[model samples]
Target chain A: MAPPTTPTLAPPDAPPPSTDLADAEPDTGRKRGLTGYLLLLPAAVWLALFFVVPFYSLAATSLYDPSGSDFRGYEMTYAFGNYVDAVQEYWTPLLRALAYGAAATLICLVLGYVLAYAIAFRAGRWKNLMLVLVIAPFFTSFLLRTLSWKLILADDGYVVDTLQFLHLLGDDGRLLATPVAVVAGLAYNFLPFMVLPLYASIDKIDPRLIEASSDLYAHPAVGFLKVTWPLSLPGVVSGTLLTFIPAAGDYINAQLLGSPNQRVIGSVIQSQFTDAGDYPSAAALSMVLMVLIVALVLVYVRRAGTEELL
Target chain B: MSAARPAARGTRPPAGRWLREHLVLVLGLLVLLYTFVPIAVVVLMSFNEGTRNVYAFQSFTLDNWANVCEDQSMCDALWVSIRIGVLATLGATLLGTLAAFALVRHDFRGRSASNLLIFLPMAAPEIVLGSSLLALFVAAGFSGQLGFWTILIAHVMFCLSFVVVTVRSRLAGMDDSLEQAAMDLYATPAQTFWRVTLPLVFPGILGAALLSFSLSFDDFIVTNLNAGTELTFPMYVWGASQRGVPMQVNVIGTVMFVLSIAVVLVGELGSRRRSRALSR
Candidate 1:
């Protein structure tokens, strides 16, 4: 799905920055040293004013407390209890979020790798059509994307109906409101993220390497395990991290497809602010998510050897 | 049976190149169909004549579309959303480009810190980001109004990250020699940037702009949280979904889909044209 906030190149397959800078070089004339700096000022100021400031406020509020549970606009509370409460209340959801995210990431990697393999090394001439189709679901309204699962996995829907017909069912034969649907929705929503990056990474792989391996004693499978998989690890790492982080916190898929028990931390945090009016607790929950995401992302980047995520 | 035949042939022994290609083509088509089916179903239901569920077949009618648009409130909400999207795009692009430049071009004090800060908004969960921003605003004496300004500010704050990322990618890929060569020609920093850097990264900037527009247009989670009493298009649709959404929502959704596709295609085409021109 296009990012709801910035929708810029869908976050995962955005062309790396080096591509654009190469375009600006004139063959003959000299380039300005400070000009790039000068040109970049507006963007810097904008980020500082809007982004840096708001987050500072978010962090600051984590250290605060409202006078009461009722909307009192917060009187600062400098303690860790809020964090404790947030953790205690929502840790299960958070863990569920992480597990779902990891599952989605793994599924995306396996499926996307296969899809990308077909497009990059296998398909020719028809490659663009395949890509267009891969991206087609993303072009529609996201609500509908999630809503499709409701149709497919609904109690008497095709999936359930088929299960019963195949004697793989019971009277209850319901797939709706299950973790399976929730995870599947998240996976479907993000599979393209995995595919696009792997496509780019795998597309650049040289066929000569495969032939060279085959020319030796290596089998095609062995050659892929050695070269193709390892070379595409960057794409895998980035795609997994990209899908996992959002899936961990996603509320929509859970809300639309899963049962009440399947509520992720995202929905809970949303409730604290909107329905419960529990601002302090919400702030603390937000902070916890922030800290966890930062920690996990740092570890992933360290492993992936890239921190180019926007 | 024929459709099945192609796939079976594909996996057959020795798998001649033709069979292999046929297998991929068939599988690719299936995947595409899987992706397209949902939207197609929704579109189909929009025209279903009966008031019952979408799954059940009925005679076709355009009445749902007519009823969906007949509401004055829906129009107002859509207008609000469009205005908000337009404003958010403008604000995000203006700021995002600068942040991208700082991230890409300069190696200054706290640069890494700044980069991390800008990136957090994108990486963090939308709920976390929205609640934090909403809380921060209220904590700073913000009143309860999900009116235009609040939504615009929030939209820009979130959207800036994309612009920054988009512009930064273009900037990173850019060769420093271009700027150095411009300096060698005796042009000032501002002039070189205007003549060289801006032109080169123009496609990225434009892409970022459209990206921001679509994002702001489609957003629900943040807008829903922050939209005090005001209703943007997505928010309205989500709320209506709770009680069963109208058919016009489908129409609006279709329209938005077409427009966004055009925008993406146009951005790609524009950049292609520029590159070809530059190469020539």
Candidate 2:
């Protein structure tokens, strides 16, 4: 409320240096170190116990014998084959999740870039109001929003009808229970993630740079490419990762808006744990997803020419 | 921050320039409209008179709004969510604010590692976090007792990272000279912190708390995994979606939407008034 809910405007990758860290003096400053450790103790301990320890448990579970049931008690036989088996069985959904996530991230970038650019450079006195509007849609429950999308894309709904009228869709073709709806839902849900970071980066660019480019012989398009796009790469990198990681792991949109045929890896992981009670298989799949994302993000951050990402 | 400056160049044709200048704004508004289409549906359908089984809006009526709690389970789930959201926010904000202060105001070894640790929870997908927490609980023999306490732990764990980031930014952006001046004016360390630091950081804490509440309240995937048989609002909606959805769900959604918007509007107006008074 104090700053109008733009708390996330700060780039996640580039954390500000601590007061002492930025100081010219190079010593650790023993008193400050003591205070720092004291203050950091509770959070550090909590994260270590719950956040860090759980990964160990998950990894251990992943290597447990796949034949063991929850009732029968799992044996940690170090069955690394669970990873191979999980991938073998669920490769299609895994690939589909990555594909869907990539498409949604790209769509979010396009739509979000337009909105963020408008708010950044063109909104005059309406800037604050527009920024608030950007976050307003997110405060509501995401499940509720996805459900509303369900209704909006219903078989007999206006969207489908309008599409048929325009001959973009066949008379019998539908938006509901389709990959389009799932991807659309993903893009809509994660659009804010994309916009906020882009706005944060784009807003910081001095307008004079763009003006200077135009003042030269450069066309407006060339000026934008030379000035705006390169300056906002940090935001683009972080925004895409923020949108893509969750989009890849989300099952809610697929579950609510798509048929069983469109199940993503998230849906598979969820069902494996909840319905099939296959903890080992679920754990294996979860680890795979986490590893794949981490590896991809590392490569992406490197190629994006930014080392700021944690 | 102001954009009232005239265009940099006046040589272009007026008509083409006007279109080019405003094109992104128009396209941006359309994108916003796309985001709001579903929220509009939620608001509209709150007045719908559809019965238990039908998904369509048949006629307009206020029955759903009037009897929002008619479905006892929905009310119960809503209460559960509210309670969890409050507790999680308080826990996360307190611990995270302390962590943020440590990171920003002081220097220590393992600082980079600590920063990465704080960032990891936010980066990981909800499904992975939820599954790993559930695994820990099961392995620790708390499998059968996975209910209120487990949900609270998971919520705090996830929310803590966000709180840290928000408060850390606010703290880092603040000027330390104000605190130094207070201390030089014969103020005790506690007095300086309470009078100078706390006021400056309070807004970040408030924002973090609000963000945490919305996140915990709207959360479905993590809460679902650790909730056991205990139901939250999102879980209620998930369960109802598979069967017949009560219109009361829409009523609650509308209420939440209205309440959050009202809060934002009031804050905006208050800030505007304050700035006006200061300028005068």
Which candidate ranks first by DockQ, i.e. highest? 2
**Which candidate tops lDDT?**
2
Residue A207's lDDT within candidate 1 is 73
RMSD (Å) of each candidate, 1 decimal: 7.0, 4.6
> What is each candidate's fraction of native interface contacts (fnat)?
0.39, 0.62
Superposed model 2: Cα runs more than 4 Å off? A1-15, A18-31, B1-8, B273-280
B246-269 in candidate 1: lDDT tens per residue? 666767766676776777677666
Which consecutive 10 residues in model 2 chain A have the weakest lDDT in total?
Answer: A1-10
